[model samples]
Target: MDLTPRTAPEAAAPSTRRRWVPLLVLGLVVAAGGVLVARFLTSAVDYYCNVDEIGERAGCEKGRSLRVQGTVEDGTIERTDGTTSFVISFN
Candidate 1:
């Protein structure tokens, strides 16, 4: 009787190779999705508006998204239906 092992069945079976194919495909898909999401988020436009800049910078076209910062004016807050809107004042 020989004591040599028969190459340990080639380190992996054919069924295992097929299984790894799907795993490799899934990993590639996830990597591509992440890259696409990152690119989309980075390419998106961002606008910033300060309290003083709002009045000074006019001609802002309608339907443009913006971020505004200011202090709420006294006696100018109005609330309705669980939502609140305020008039901001900047010195």
Candidate 2:
């Protein structure tokens, strides 16, 4: 081949595409992870409310798991072989 004088020996800056590609990929991964974590945390969170306020409160919607606070009434506790069920009252 032809001989040319080398002014700069591999001392050039890296191209913009090579540098920004990884950074862009990392940013997208982080955003996706954040969205997944947020959805998981929100789904794991349960609604807490009083027994009497089940239908009146926004967090006490039916068919949803809830942490209801109430006083246990006597004679309502039933202990079966594998389960113990009871009734509670707020008033």
Candidate 3:
């Protein structure tokens, strides 16, 4: 008489992670594209200055592009040689 045990071969489990890697990579690519577009759009906007901020003269200089906001005084408009100039008060 003999005492012995028999064993059967088992197959490996299938992997489900392969499907998620491509999706994750696609999401990352879309997010990076959005950030780059936003940065470029913001850079195109021009800078502006207030009436009281003219004396600072840090970023303000001649021939530089900028916007200024002020209220024109009554009857201060002058037109000469197809040009116009006006005086503004901060009051």
lDDT of all predictions: 0.76, 0.91, 0.77
How well is each residue in 14-40 modelled by candidate 2, as lDDT tens digits? 899999999999999999999999999
Once all C-alphas are superposed, what RMSD does model 3 give against the true structure? 7.7
Task: Please give, for residues 12-65, the per-residue lDDT of candidate 1 as tens digits.
Answer: 556878989999999999999999999998767556777677546753334566
TM-score of 2: 0.74
Report the number of clashing residue pairs per model.
0, 0, 0
Residue 18 in model 2: lDDT: 90
Better of 1 and 3 by lDDT: 3
Per TM-score, the best of the predicted structures is 2
Q: Order the candidates by lDDT, highest first — what do you get?
A: 2, 3, 1
lDDT of 1: 0.76
Cα error, candidate 3, residue 49 (Å): 0.7
- TM-score of every model? 0.42, 0.74, 0.44
